[model samples]
Target chain A: MNVIDHVRDMAAAGLHSNVRIISSLLLTMSTNNPELFSPSQKYQLLVYHADAIFHDKEYRNAACKYNMALQQKKVLSKTTKVRPSSTGGTTSALQAQNLPSEIEVKYKIAECYTILKLDKDAISVLEGIPSRQRTPKINMMLANLYRKAGQERSAVTSYKEVLRQCPLALDAIIGLLSLSVKGAEVASMTMDVIQSIPNLDWLSVWIKAHAFTHGGDNQRCGTWKHFGI
Target chain B: MNVIDHVRDMAAAGLHSNVRIISSLLLTMSTNNPELFSPSQKYQLLVYHADAIFHDKEYRNAACKYNMALQQKKVLSKTTKVRPSSTGGTTSALQAQNLPSEIEVKYKIAECYTILKLDKDAISVLEGIPSRQRTPKINMMLANLYRKAGQERSAVTSYKEVLRQCPLALDAIIGLLSLSVKGAEVASMTMDVIQSIPNLDWLSVWIKAHAFTHGGDNQRCGTWKHFGI
Candidate 1:
């Protein structure tokens, strides 16, 4: 196996320190012999190195490496397009190799920014993804960052999007309520998402209790006790 | 693509009701035309059908399908072993196809059991996995189930196991504290996990705040405000 593969195996085995050392060493060696590795290999190496650094709590360095990996991936994508016939095969093979996808790498970069308390940067990275490509996880992250940044309107939109995809996401429900969304509106949205689920009437009651508790409507909250809370 | 693959794609595209209908139809067809699918294909179909059912909030039926998928996987494994040389190739290919692993299927079954409020069955499904293969997610689920079952000692052990793997798991920390674990012991354990992270001395303070609050020691909790809470 190649050095990158070895480092990946070490990573899979949870030998983070070993992976960090080997990946860093190989990355340095590649600088003197650039032709020694393909663009995809270089990208994978950088990600592995960054992942190990991230595991070791070096968020700043990890973010830098992840950014570099993203650049390398862009380069790889460009080169793959030049060889049209092999593009599909190469893409599938890389996926089989379990390298981080572009979206996953971006998410990691955002996570690093979040840990460093750079909420704006994190939000930008997440928002840069095309809306159609945004998964529930991405939307949840954006919703949280928006809430923290006090962009209540955007937070409300993102939280609602998350609920549409995952009705059982209790945090999103609470997030919407805390953002001063009308409880009835939030409950109506939840009902639309969960309508197909049979015998889930208690969920609406539970959500009402949360809404009342968050809204500080103690009179309404107390009435929920009739449902046995 | 085949019906199972199409169902998976539909599920991924958020066409859950379509997946439920088509997968159910395909599963019934497979009963008559058993020769039409390979064992792995059969397993994948069952998982997809169960996933759709699970998504529709049919926990009991989903649990049954997931259990059947597990049994199919066992048959697949035994057949795989009979062809020794092809074992490695088949296993890797199966992984590339993104079929759920045995551990993941077990976790899903446990989730269904948990939702059905069959705490004992949930605990048993979780515990049946070999200890080494028990991931933090599994341990966390098991820990919650154990706590609910009032098996305090097992709950404590599972919570600690989760903390060891994931120090930033705030819920596990809270679980430990709520179980009446000594505040000092829990804090010391957290310190060991976060020691490598720079400028994270505040994490210890944060954990201490949680511990004191859970312990109902208001005086110590109040003292934390000097660190700005």
Candidate 2:
């Protein structure tokens, strides 16, 4: 079997040592003979090496390789699109099937940033994804990342937006609830947002906190204090 | 104004110093004259203080206070549930309204862990939430926490499960794509999963990568290298 085939098999079998060895060899071979490898091959080689490094927790290096793959992908798409007819239908099909979407690649890069604790870079990459295209999962990710970065207002807003889209969204609900409970005047916009959740069991809890903090029918709270548990 | 009212007003107005003064007064008064504040009221004081500290980014302190608030809430619930009639309907309503849900409290705790970079603790808290009760946001949160904790196999599995439930789940898809691209053999179940994604532009790329590494008709790849972009 050729080196690539043996490496592929080793990778499929979870042979990290073999996968690493072949990936390095392939990368070196491709690097020395750049013209011999097609753009897609270049992308694949970078990804293979990145994947190997990434598996070893070499995130920074992996990120660099993944970045190069994306660059190759971009160049491949642009140049290939320009000469669609010369490459023909098969080429079109190949191009269409191969190459991760821009969002997918960016997401990978963002994940790398996150692993490295480069919160700002991770947010930047994730933010590149269009808002309308954001799935609930993506929104949650963005919200958490924002929260971690201590952009409290933006984080709370993103979490609330997730709640607005889905009332049952527990993470956002938890996010909002925590934000409400943690000390942002329980009377602000985030506190007010509890009303948006339909019949949420925790709504009353927030309301009570607001009442305690802001002057809401002290007599009722007093009566509870006098006799209530 | 009574201490609670004064504290509430100050907290609402973002007057941290004034809120602190009133809350302290209430706490002391409650300690001196236990009858003056109900368990809920005491819990509210702790939360108020916690909130203030939390706003100041005193997360460790805030977390401690929040934990105490939850302890008070737990004790209050137990005692209140036992003597339902003595407390009356208003008391029932008050108790119900005043205490955050167990899930909400746990979520807040998880937030503290996340801020502390205690990813495993965050995951444990989030995972305690029942799967059926998990909103997309929660699942995403758990998945990410798992990933952050270096539970890659579990992370990829969770991401794929999210994708199974939601084909449009971009984060999960990207997660799977990245997992597939990074180090694991491109020819395994990960590659097979690409077939499940309908009309995704990136499926072919993974298939191509797998095929390239594992020896899938090298002639085709060879031809592509010769003429394909």
Candidate 3:
């Protein structure tokens, strides 16, 4: 089998640790036959390399690989001038033709920063995302970053946004409830999440534990106990 | 407060990223006052230093500090044989002479081994615990370690031990159910855990998400819905 086939077999076997070796072999092979891979193929190779780096706990290396893949995908889109069938060209050609969205890349960049414990850089990268494209996942992550940075109030607001986007965002909802809060808001949000998330029993139990520690009403605690929630 | 107090204060504040400065200052202070701290105080200080090392992504340093703390704790116990009333101690002089129980020290040693990802060392340390004295907490950790080591059967047995000791050990119950044979055994364990666990909803969700993954229940996909579990 060819190098690509071997690499595919490795990935399929979940031997992600061997991706670097695969990348090195592929890169050397490609040097002799530069046109052996199309843009998409090259992007796939880079993504696999990124996966290898991530699995190896080299976050910076992984992030760099992802950035390289994104760049290559962008160059391919520019050269090919291919339009994505969906999005009606509403998204920039760069994003539409790329392997991942700009928002996703930015989120990944933020994740790398977070892993490195560079909270400032993480927040900065996250803040670069446009308001409209800030989906529930992004909001939830931002909320977590805010909490990590010790900016509790900002975290609450971002978490609230997550709940608004996806009412069943349990982590965000629970985070808000854990904070010192108005009685009415906590009760309403708690009720909302209970109805929305189909099997959120364990999360509710954790919340109840927090509630008991912080002296929430006996009725609320009793409700948790009674429902086996 | 002296230089030591300042360093201790920084540690207490969770600003542990400055290992270079902390270590340098500690080294200088230790050089100046070689006999300044009591053995217990020195050990506690070493623990703090070890935490900073871990935070700094210096696993080697962290491991060394932890080893020092364990060794120091042992040496101090030998010198100061008084049984402190703060924690319960068996009336047996030999048992009381130690800082904590064999289980507790073994647990710490296991923790250090885990941080270094010396799975073999960790396994040995944990397995050294006499079966009779192993508590639910230690059993749960050992089960997790076995799972990490891909010794699924051992993991299952350890988790079962945890559940046998404490039926309400939610984590161990979930772990045990996940590793058990598919079909009737898993279903029975699920029902058993669902019945006994106070937080049924949460426990169900966690188990279904994880356990179903292992059992490959087609009905329970999308995190935990695949097994119809």
Candidate with best TM-score: 1
**Candidate 3 lDDT by residue in tens digits, B126-193:** 89888888866577678889998899999988877765644334455556656664433434554654
- By DockQ thresholds, what CAPRI class is model 3? incorrect
**Index of the highest-lDDT prediction:** 1
TM-score of each: 0.51, 0.39, 0.41
What tier of docking accuracy does candidate 2 attain?
incorrect
Candidate 1 lDDT tens digits, B80-197: 7786566488765755468767888899899899889898999999999999999877888888888988999999999898778655555677789999998788887767646765
Candidate 2 local accuracy as lDDT? 0.60
Residue B165 CA displacement from its true place in model 2, Å:
31
Query: Residues B36-131, candidate 2, lDDT per residue (tens digit)?
Result: 777877877877767677656677777787788888888887877888788687968876774445565666667677788887777887787777
lDDT of candidate 1 over A49-77, digit per residue (tens): 89989977899999999999999998987
Instruction: Kindly report the TM-score of the first chain in candidate 2.
Output: 0.66
Number of colliding residue pairs in model 1: 0
- Kept native contacts, fraction for each prediction: 0.00, 0.00, 0.00
After superposition, the stretches of candidate 3 with alpha carbons farther than 4 Å from their true spots are A1-9, A28-34, A80-106, A128-137, A150-154, A164-170, A177-183, A193-229, B1-229
Q: Chain A TM-scores, all candidates?
A: 0.88, 0.66, 0.65
| Predictions: Cα RMSD each | 16.2, 16.1, 22.3
Tell me how each candidate scores on DockQ against the true complex: 0.03, 0.03, 0.01
Task: Tell me model 3's lDDT, rounded to 2 decimals.
Answer: 0.62
